[model samples]
Target: MANFPLNRRQLIGGMTAGALAPAVLRAHSRGSAGRAVVVGAGVFGVWTAKALMDAGLHVTLMDANGPANARASSAGESRMTRGAYGPDEIYTRMALASLSDWKALSVSAELPLFHAHGVLFFFHEEIDYFRQSLEVHHRLGLPTEELTPEQMAARYPMIDYDGVAVGLFEPEFGAIMARRSVQTLVAQMVLGGLDYRRGKASPLTMPRGPSPLGAVRLDDGSQIEGDIMVYALGPWMPQGFPDILDRKIVTSRQEVFFFAPPAGSDDFSPAKMPGWADFDAGGLHYGFPDLEARGAKICFDNHGPEVDPDTNPRQVTKEGLAEIIAYRDRRFPKLRGAPLLETRVCQYENSSNGDYLIDRHPGYTNVTMVGAGSGHGFKMGPEVGRLAARVALGEDLGEPRFTLATKGTTQARSVI
Candidate 1:
């Protein structure tokens, strides 16, 4: 793992040699053919479309509310890009691959989108998950450190680790600007001659023969045809294909809050504090340092009630705010009464068992349905998009965890 620096001018110099060349070569390969129509312009859809374009295909991207809109799950200030999966090595690898692409894109964009402040995990009782994760990290040669409670207290003295049993630090991981990165990818692709449109799209009809999906109907009574079609609709999966995904994937309401630190205090900034995750008995709470002075970001990981992404009000609740404030007060006494700077309400399109659903539509071989971010999918967007593109182009990833058949109807949430 490369510990990429956050300096805007040194972004390119921070990357490992030849880090960006493979992705660029893969994109411009002459292996894939025909036209591709992708629905949804979120991180997943955008990356999949980019992958298709790189594979030498004519690709058209459509979005209902534009890229990373307020309603989309990818719309947020920042998202953590860490490799801690509590023993799930597959996701850890996926996150690492995605991180490379993120770093490459970050340097190419106007601003360095990835902030390399590192990530800290504060564990509670039962250290089995942490131990197994440490083993995987060591085996993979990832730079990870096991810190004692005393070490954590010495390094991050601003936060009070009352009941924290141990800490795991990954110095190479940090945060990725969410909305900005997605929009940047879309713009870069569009500037490179990729077709991007703002419209609502749905399959014209279920494929009943060996022929591929003919076309998709748009909201304005228009239609877009393609030899390969991908539906990476984030939260809209259940609504778009209710008959198959209604029970397989679910949408949950999630609340995020940003608290303003004390004036003239750099204690909560990225330079001083790393992005941290607390595995307490109550629930998993994670947050980032004050990057771009947008306050300290915090959110609980427990999935909220199921919601309809289309009609659900994007508003934080009083109760949710109270809960986070209480946690903040306990963890960081200095921020006990910090003013609330901002709040965002989003949705998580979670698949059962917390794994992604990247597979071909059972009714149509030419169409691939990709989604089920399950809250932690944002950081894995680049790799997910690439896998979705491969599946759309008639190649199998051979990873059953991502196959539709492996997705249970009940939400077990085995993956973090």
Candidate 2:
């Protein structure tokens, strides 16, 4: 394990970001402190709550299972952070911007929330996403080192590079402590005077008056009202605000498995191996370097069957389990029979296209809706939160692609 504790100088820099705040937070800081109610304690919700609180707003953050609940999409050990979005430079830059904020938050908290161990994408010749990513990375000046199969085998012998035709190593891309980071952010915000509540958010109840705003009713029969209400319920978005997100957002069941490495196997450690994604697989399957002798984390990223977040059984299906074992055997032959350490079934809020849905509810301007992480949105939490906070504060982010109108009923996935 590496110690990325904040140094004195880095602490000063991060502290200055607090005084000046980020551009998005600064925009809201100009106004008087407004009372806002934020539903959900996932990455997007926490970051949005923190941004609003930082901008001098009194925020009441509510969640069913507290911060980074096991049921939440953001509750995971490690999340990949990469700028290789194929042709989507929008997310590429937004990811970089979010990384800056993550580093700053790590400094402020003095904890290593992000690990820049780099990410390797291996692909076969027919994989068009590889070339598309290279074009975007090259245009954005993101550093990458191309590798041949032989080169990859010479470097990472653990990975079976049989079908790997082209390899790209992005040194700046890395992984973040997803669940820990979200919990830590929420704790810090609470300590910084945010009102953290524990309860599931019910539908918004509109007051019978000329006012455009409404109060968020909790499952506890408690009504929490605010000048602005942000519904960032992640997969629960479609369930809570059906009319707005009915066909626009879908929640899918995702499965992840951790395998015990070979006895005395330091080869799978982060120092030796970086995070890797094998596009050569039939679908997207990514891995994190072994973490502290626990296990090697591997998960398939292709959208799974649509599920209801509230009632669906959150367990890996036998078919999905067998498929992952087969994938592991094919991609990493050395860890074929490793003991299964753990299996986690998570719900991912996905859009028809993988782009996030961040826009105001057409009926209410003050109630900003944020979600549809689509599995790839966790790394950009800070930027997304900034945008959400701005919108909740009544600013037009002007991002048409993220608007609800752009989301469709058909599941023609494009952006990764």
Please give, for residues 1-416, the per-residue lDDT of candidate 1 as tens digits. 45433332222122222322232235436453467899999999999999888777789999999999989999999999998887798888788778888988999999889999999998886577888889878866789999988999999887888898989999989999999999999999999988998899853444565455668887678899877789999999977786678789999999999999889989999999999999988889999999999999989988998998888788899999999999999998989899999999988999988999999888876788999999999999988888888778666667899898887788888888
> How many clashes does the backbone of model 1 have?
1
lDDT by residue for model 2 (85-148), tens: 8778788777766777777766677667877788998887746777877887776566778889
Q: What is the lDDT of residue 235 in candidate 2?
A: 86
Q: Per-prediction count of colliding residue pairs?
A: 1, 0
Off by over 4 Å in 2: 1-32, 107-111, 205-211
Write down the TM-score of every candidate.
0.91, 0.89
RMSD of each: 5.7, 5.3
Model 1, residue 375: C-alpha shift (Å): 0.3
| TM-score of candidate 1 to 2 decimals | 0.91
